[model samples]
Every structure is written in structure tokens, then in C-alpha cells.
Target: REMLVAEIEKRLPAWEKKTHLKCNGWQTKIMQNKWGSCNPAGKLWFNLHLAHTPIRCLDYVILHELLHLKVRHHNKDYIALLDKYMPFWQEVRKELNDFVLMPMK
Candidate 1:
């Protein structure tokens, strides 16, 4: 968890500086249908399953939610912002979606 937070902090500086956005905190937990979620209040959470995926995938999820802090919906403006920050975000998103995690049972 500490490592993940560190990575988030590292990746966040430029975005935060550029957009003046801030994230209060984050955590990880088992999620059935989503890799992450963010609220208007700036709190973020990641699916515990992300621990097993590639670091870039985790970064992708974090960035996705962080962008939500600025853009409330997946509209054109939101997508343009994502493209500006993470140019290949669509490819990264596809990789994340294509990844298969075994069922907990």
C-alpha cells in the first residue's frame, strides 16, 4: 500500500501542478466490477485485484479516477483531458479491461 501511494504521489505532481487538483487519500479493496472509483470529495479507492496487475495498469486506474476529480463525467472534455495527460490512456485502458483475474470463490 505504501509503495502504491508513493507511486501515486510521484505521478501526481505534474497533474496536480498543471490542473491544480488534489486527492485527499486512497485505499484498496476487493471490487467485483470496477478497478477503481473516485468521489467528488477527492477520495479514491482501487480494487485489491490491481496489486497483481502490471504497475502501468495500476497507474492507469489511478489517473482515471484522479481525472474524475476535475471532470465529473466521461464527456469529450474529460476524454480530452485524459489524452492530454496520458496520451496512450485508451490502450492502457484496453489492457486493463482485457486482463483476467481469477474468481475468489
Candidate 2:
């Protein structure tokens, strides 16, 4: 958990410069059907499965939800935000889908 936070913090400047959004905090826990989730209030959660993913892929998920702090939902604004910060995000997403471990719901 601490290591993940450090990685996220290291990437924060890039996210801020590109998306101009802030993330309140982050946590890792078991989740069945989610890679990550975000709330309008700036909280973000990640599936513990991410601990097994490549660092770049984890960054993509973290950045994806952090961008949601500025634009909720997978609408144009959100996609645009992701595009600006992570051009290769779709590739990462695909890799995540292929490799993610599902937890009991």
C-alpha cells in the first residue's frame, strides 16, 4: 500500500500538469469486477489485483480514476483527459483485461 502510494505520488505532477485534477487519497482492496473506481469527492480505489500488474499499467489505472475527479463518467471529457495524460492507456487497459485476477464478489 505504501509503495503504491509512493508511485502514485511520483506520477502526481504529470497528472496535475496534464489533467489539472487532484486526488484525495488511494487504497487497495479486493474487488471483483473493477480495476479501479473514483468518486466525485476525489477518493479513489484500486483492486488489489493491481499489485500484480506492471507498473505502467497500474499507473494507467490510477491516472484514469484521478482524471475522473475532474470529469466523471466515461464521457468525452473523461476520454479526452485520459488521452492527454496517457496516450497508450488503451493498450494498458487491454493488457489489464487480459491479466487481471477476479476476486469473489
- Work out the TM-score per prediction: 0.81, 0.81
List RMSD in Å for every model shown.
2.3, 2.5
CA displacement after TM-score superposition, residue 47 of candidate 1 (Å): 1.0
Runs with alpha carbons beyond 4 Å of true place in candidate 1: 1-6, 9-19, 101-105
lDDT (CA) per prediction = 0.80, 0.78
Clash count, predicted structure 1 = 0
Give candidate 2 misplaced runs (Cα > 4 Å).
1-5
Q: How well is each residue in 46-90 modelled by candidate 2, as lDDT tens digits?
A: 877777778988888878888778777899988887887788889
Per-residue lDDT value at 90 in model 1? 91
Q: Candidate 1: global Cα-lDDT?
A: 0.80
Model 2 per-residue lDDT at 62: 76
lDDT of 1 by residue, 50-94 (tens): 767788888778778888998889999999988887899999999
Worst 10 residues of 1 by lDDT: 11-20
